[model samples]
Target: MGYSRGIGIVGLGVISRAYLETLVGHADVRIVAVADLDAERARAVAETVPGARALSVSELLADPEVDTVLNLTIPAAHAEIAHGAISHGKNVYGEKPLTAVLDDARAVMASAAAAWVHVGCAPDTVLGTGVQTARAAIDAGHIGRPIAATAAFFSAGHESWHPNPHFYYLPGGGPLFDMGPYYLSALVHMLGPIVTVQGAGSRTRSVRTIGSGPREGETLDVEVATHVTGVLTHASGALSTVTFSFDAHASEAKPIEVHGEAGSLSVPDPNYFDGDVRISRGDGWELVPVSAGYEHGSRGVGLLDFAVGDAPARRASGELALHTLEVMTLLLESAETGERRRVSTAPERPEPVPLTTEAEWRRIADA
Candidate 1:
């Protein structure tokens, strides 16, 4: 049997606010406790959640009332936190990238299997209306046999905005690692699993200055490529060109586009739950109405599917996140080696989300 809907959160950072807001009031799930490296932060957040306590990380993981651990830790700590959760017989739902390294993530998957616990990860935004509608269109043959695509994620760097942006420049932290999950996860769903990848990367500066939060003007060394461009060959024979960049000032490109023999599709930002998904015939790009997925969805919506929903599959399963991670890691490998790299993981595209209204799915998207 699957774990209960009781939840314990680990790592109370910036992203924790969104998860807390989304999960706190849900009926099917209970927020049993929250733990963070910072005890004060955990205590403060727990104070706001009725019946939720601030516990040490170990205590929260071992709490029998908690069936799942919502891991909101940094990339480096993802694997460790998740392993801890599974060790205590808890399911785990986490923020994106899965882990900072590929091998560590693999071990997490292995551990989950051995422990018989479920693992789910984020960018559940893909399960939202925009991407799902677009996906439904593709599956419905609105874009006949998707042949190609372009996914672009461009940013000037999060250093200026994120409180502690140092991680964004590290080996596992660039635009591809930070923002690529949404694009890659959406692409995998729309185009199927990526089999081969070739990429090239570059960095514009060695150090970046912090732009916002408490530590403005602080400079951190940049260790990873700031700009990454790649070509992914999906198992279905579709090819996708991707450009993920922190060096870019801006872009005119749509977030993602899919071209098929019959027509083309413009997908909304995969990072967000809702937007306008447009399709283009010979005439021009036309808005595709919300045809599928949870209406008015938000963060942690994917975790809801994991908690209480019974479907053919968990749409936001950790396996998919692992595949997304493997793809990104291989993209970097390909870039560094100047050789086409074959991805080792091949996660199935999640089942499509049925069209449901905000009034309906919202009640449980938080579950």
Candidate 2:
């Protein structure tokens, strides 16, 4: 294994900042290059990191020094960028949903398989202390024989703050697709894989008006459902209720709650790295100490996981993303068809990440 993994990043967008913030000074990986449609944007971002160079997308993919590609592009471009990296003989770690479309995701997976490279995607938040601790509790029998789970994420439209809120309303972008990965990924971590799903969805308005940025008054057409509710049947015979929405302004429900035979666990937001995992065993809610998962983890921990291993790290594998994508997209399908849909794809439950203090992980990385 190499002392430092060479990484080239593509799509220097808003989310890219979070990854850079996490990976820039980390010892496990080296940011060799960066690229974006706006060359100036990539250059600006690269300048902040020592030894990182700004390159064109194609050049970055082809750079022999780049062992992996960190793809931070929009949903539509995910597969294309990932395929490009794989074709160039580099592993790829990308943002969520895998691809905007299922067929495209399949193609990307097949391509990586053929090339014998690795593909990983986001919502690695599942590897963080919050979800990991929850998983640990379940595995340790703290929550005996999990029965049901609830994943709720309700919030106002992103147009209220996002400068480029237009994408959230597009076909691949919706309340479900935009935020469902986090919820679903956490559920899978706590329970098991989903086997079937039935759902109902609705759209609030035909258009949304931006409330911030220079384009504050601009309107974007709503091309996808705003509210989605579903029931997921897990392979373990457990059922998980999912509620994701961008049509509402507030929600009093916990982000996620998993109920088992012995007790119920309140999991923190899957979009975040760490938070308290509370459990209730009839007496009252009590905090479960952070017993497992990465401490002080952040956005790029998945990429960092990818970097430390020879193969695509299971903690953030593409198969996990594929399962998550299938679960979410099927919810939309079931909503449209007004019938329950069986999920044909079943990704293996990613191995649990043991409690590893960030400092220890770094020490091992630096060794």
Clashing pairs in 2: none
Which stretches in model 2 have alpha-carbon errors above 4 Å?
310-313, 362-367
Instruction: Give the least accurate 10-residue stretch of model 1, judged by summed lDDT.
Output: 358-367
lDDT of 1: 0.89
Taking the tens digit of each residue's C-alpha lDDT, what string does model 2 give over 314-360?
67888888888888888999999999999988888888888879886
Full-model lDDT for every candidate: 0.89, 0.88
